[model samples]
Target: MTYTFDIIGVTPIPKFVQFQHQFAKKPDRSKTYLGSYECSLDGLISATKMIPHKPNWDWDQVLEEIINFWVQSEESIQHWKKQLYTVREESLLVARVANSEALRQEFETLWQE
Candidate 1:
């Protein structure tokens, strides 16, 4: 599928970069939601700097790099999912342990009283 990228913002810092993938064929042109990447002020500035010397630069290479940096790979998504799951499991275990410890302390206090 073909896609287009748009930089959304008016101020010195752009809000984000939006990309839309073309899903429908021509004559019934339609775009589907791809994703957006929040742009940092420094990144925007650096990107602009690359544009000035464009005549001598490889535009295709530049586009490829930008897309690669913005797009999330399947492996990256899976890795992030695993990391989140591990964090959540650890947090739940810690909470359960803390709750049991608190209950034990309460029982001891009551028995002593």
Candidate 2:
């Protein structure tokens, strides 16, 4: 079974569709806000079934794809700072949620640090 989750803020580098094939298959990958300088895409979707997420998903992968997207994109890094991207870091939490309740507690404990 597929679960739905939000890919908080996904915007285009240009005024129109960027179609970052990296996340193309993701369902409802639609543009949201458009300003004088940038465009955005936002959605909650059935991740695996809708989009082709890279496998062997490690915590580093999260930092790479989602976090590093704007950081490495010289042109966009500034935008990330301006927006004040605030997301709950839940990398280990996800795995813990499935492993065991105790593990989940441990995940949160580690995260709080």
Choose the strongest candidate by lDDT: 1
Residue-level lDDT of model 2, residues 1-113, one tens digit each, is 11112123433334123433533344332222111222222111112223243332332333334333433455554444345334232111010001133335657888899
Q: lDDT per residue, candidate 1, 1-113, as tens digits?
A: 22233332221111112111122122222211112122332343245342221222334544544455446444543443354345422211000001233345657888998
Off by over 4 Å in 1: 1-50, 73-113
TM-score computed on alpha carbons, candidate 1: 0.21
Per-model CA lDDT versus the true structure: 0.31, 0.30
What is the Å distance of residue 103 in model 2 from its true position? 26
List the RMSD of every prediction in angstroms.
Answer: 23.8, 15.3
TM-score of each: 0.21, 0.20
